[model samples]
Target: MRTTPLLVAAPLAVALALLPVMLVASGAQQVGLWSPWTAAPALATGVALAAVLLPRLDLPRLPWPSALLLLALCAGLGTWAALTHGEHLVVRRDPGAYATYALALARYGGVPLDPGLDVFGLPASDPWVRVGAAANYAVPGTGADGSATLLVSPQFLVGVPALLSGAWLVGGWSGLLVAPAVVAALALAAFAGLAAQLLGARWALLATALLGVSQPVVLVARQTFSEPFSLLYLLTAATLLVLAAASRGQRARLPALVAGLLLGAHLLVRIDAVRELVLLVPLVALLAGRRHPAAGPLAVGTLLTGVPAALATRWWDSPYVASVASSLGPLVAAGAVVTVLSAAALLLGRRVARRWDTTGVPRAAVRAAALLPAVAAATVALVGVGLASRPLWLVDSREPYLPGMEQFVGALQQQQGLPVDGLRTYAEDSVVWLVWWLGPVTVLLALVASVVLAAVGTRAVLSRQPLPRWLLPVVVGLAVTVLSLYRPAITPDHPWADRRYVTVTYPYLVLAATATLAWLVGTGRRGTRPAAAVLAAAMLLPTALATLPLATARTETGQVAAVGAVCAALEDAGPRPAVLAVGFRARVEWAPVVRARCGVPFVGIEEPSAPAGTTLGQVLGDAAATARAGGYAPVVLVGDLTSAQTVADATGVTLPPVVSLRTTEPERLLEERPLETREMTVDAWLAPLP
Candidate 1:
């Protein structure tokens, strides 16, 4: 097939050009690759130039080198955004758990949860928690005084690690710093590739550009988190699932295998992709229609290959999922209604009926079989909602220091009886629906436009218009995706279930929506560019507005203290006599570092819970074990005296006298040596009984 010259130029220039991420880390390595890659503004300028030039280039078919370069370009720019933008780039806490845990696992040749080996790093309050969840290796230097042992975390998806591997290949620190962006780039490529394939290159480019700047995605990409990267795997799976349905007479085993694997991998990272697996029925329907029997093999392969990580959730965390809230009803209903209505509209369109029939009996039968996949997908949504309603997955919402929020959570815990599964359903559900001004208005408009498009597409289909067979699925998939979003809210605090995790899917969803809409609108010949640009602009402006403050707060000069966190962790890994942690952020960034590098084990004695991932008692338990096992045996435990006193009162666990150390600095790291060792006890429970 002859390729577009613009496609050829886009990848080549992206690979060769400057990227925005280069402006942040010009080969500077923090804990990993993103810290390096040297965010040179020149690189960003070059990328910007390429971004402009490549699209306009009217080149022709390109070779493998060109394709490889294109992939590299996509990978690079994506990595840039991932690092410079995601996870505070400097270090945000959400996915910090993954990095710290991965580093911990990797440190020991990919050991998952070993008791003998001490986890090295700081800044991580519950490195083990993250290590176990991510199910990877290598404990990151948390830029803190302690580290978490990856007792079992290897379940994390390969997205971040794969990208980091690329950066690592580049050099030590440079690769590590570049890794996040690189991985994010790959993710972007997957996202863009699908977008372009389904929505046309123009829409794909516009969606991707917006994605590059969306604050939440940037935050995820900037750090070594996997959500953004994993989303690619998820999208890839969904795309493949669609393909599997259509390629009946062909050998889809390899592609189906890949899709299943991708789906499984995505589950490993987040455990939520299982919801999409419900579409197995639909997939099977397609396979069965051709007597292909590909469904059984496909199912077996996906389950067998993905089982280790998919089941890793239970292996790593306590039991079932546990979290504070279980209110996905709102998000699910909303997402479901949207999805169903959208799909129903598109499928019912007049155009679809005629063209669908023109495919002849064999093709028609194949298309009819698609109903199974759709039904299966719906089943998946139902199952997810069911699992979520019962509540599995451990979740910790910061409350103590947040004043009113503490009562809020307390009331929730009391009302819900503390869902021990720790499965934070709200994080999955409501966060998306939240009325944050973070996304582009185009997302909303896309939904509206998609309805009209569905109408038009249906008309064209019924009238036997020349829309490709491929398009019919794209429209259906888009509708299904939109419907899938309507699962129960994992986060009641946030609405729409459209939070950070799921927004990555928005590119595909929106693209499909727009594609159907545009197809229906007839892709007007003369003003297509202007119309698309206006639509893109409308959809994207809100995200830019939402991200302004975040970007400002993320500059190198501003995050010096965060830098100190890693330095402090490095200091602890050595033989530092005293390992102290300040706030939650301070502890998260520093403790893990100190634990890993200094080999000095310390506990974060701060607020009871919330944001830090666990109670102070939990950190104490791990520290006590680490210190005792390491033979250092903490001579003095440091923290807020008032909070320390509360621990003493709550659990009856005595505190060794605390003497405030306030010499040069204002905040103090109180000292309390352990008189004896024992199991930790806490007053407030985290969740329900497993």
Candidate 2:
């Protein structure tokens, strides 16, 4: 088969070209200096760099047929993503948080947002006043000297926001909304490139199609989530690694270095990407011992970006880092151990190869290795059985960390008509979660294929032969997938939790399943090839059936219009230099939107039960008094009529809602798959300070 470097290089180029843009934007934001101007120049420089350097790699062109297929897949998926794209503008979940972060970066240029609190002249020492000043994701705190208050920063890293900010600059909100579709298309192309390198072009097309059509892939592609960006980076990195491995001499070093840089860049995209970085250490050492010319460069390239990203995250996104510190600490320790062990093994292996004689090895050991494929297959089956049976015997629950998370879960359970168990994680049903989306057939096939591939990898290791370039990535992907499934540290809600699968599991399984079919087709007798093809075609049925329900059902519909209505109402309310203080229920979902879209200073009032020192009425009275004194109109905002009445009573103002609309929100499922969205009414009441 002819090499098709352009197929992979094209998508990789796009992502690599944006690397510097993300870095520069993030670095600028670190010093509160980020803006569209900063990103534009960085983007131009990155494009120019990619144009010059990528061509110098001298990658071969993709065949026209393969190119056409890739184009078709991207076009189809991109169109679907656009038509069904979500309007997750309300900061209720990760997608909303990401969108708000991008909005802040695009509009305000940086975080630690100044909500003009100094103008309000409220007592910062008042606990209730402080609670009212906080927004979801945008944690509120005082400045260095602890005198002035500011929205401390946004959660998660700057990668998604930095990238999305460029889209916002070019096309405003519309561009930001459709940016994920573009990312999805690029990610699909990258996945195809990696698949084409490992399998043949025909099989790669099948794999790409399978993955592209999967529900989880489609679900995330429609929203502003980090998974799509992470997918693009990881797939591009793997594709480049394969290209590097296939090349010889100094020619191989460039792609390997680029691959390492991409993996390092993944750190910017995801804090947990340190796992991938750690996993690369052993693979690099193994390749080095095999006399691979690219190994050293790969290591050097990773350190180039990885070191800076780590330090930057620690400094700028410290809250997010601290939030995941429990998991991150153990992961880091494990990585250190793996790095040391891998280095020792690499050294010890070289010595053994030079001194020991393979001829003295027992024949039984070889026979046991030969049976590895069977052993692997059985292990996969047993593990699946174990996980599938977990719900039957296990009742999993956990303490909620996020404020009001338990209450939120209880509400969802009440809506779903289940026994209200606020603490129930439903984590034990994680395997069943996979079955809900991938279907039993695809899951089984993927498991078998994964294990079989591992068996083949084991044999190569024992024989001291250089491992397949794709093997390292596959192994790392599998390890991470397993870990994610075991502990998906997200709100245990369907579709929301499904984003966990999008990062690696869904793509990896699609690749594995397609590869398995390809193996069957290639190894079968000439006459049996058609039968194998029929079998392969038959296998897609379960996945197609699984995806049929949500293929066109758009979630979070009408949200954009709802938010726009609120912004418009706020603007028209004759509130020059207005400050919007949202009620507790609205704070998490609308505080950021009010500030970013309405272009007004915003604050969030905590729930009535909050441990804040003052009553809700006192907080409202203070907010009103401060706003009048500062010559700014103070508007109260709430998400529902109940909350609006609560605020109205507290302020002694008859607050009639200014904005009332209903939008579709993704449904929360307990033990079943989410098939449709539920209607959610969004109400916002704006009243003058009394």
- Which is the leading candidate under lDDT? 2
Q: Model 1, 296-368: lDDT tens per residue?
A: 5566656754565534334333222323112222333454555465445544543454565686445665576
Q: Tens digit of lDDT per residue, candidate 2, span 146-220?
A: 665655467789988889878888887779888998888989988887787788778878778778887888888
Q: Cα lDDT for residue 301, model 1? A: 52
Q: After superposition, how far is residue 573 of candidate 2 from its true place, in Å?
A: 3.5
lDDT of model 1, residue 459: 45
- Candidate 1 ranges beyond 4 A from true positions: 1-92, 109-174, 239-248, 251-253, 290-297, 311-441, 448-504, 520-533, 548-593, 602-690
Q: Which residue pairs collide in model 2, if any? A: none
Q: Clashes in candidate 1: how many?
A: 175
- lDDT of each structure? 0.42, 0.76
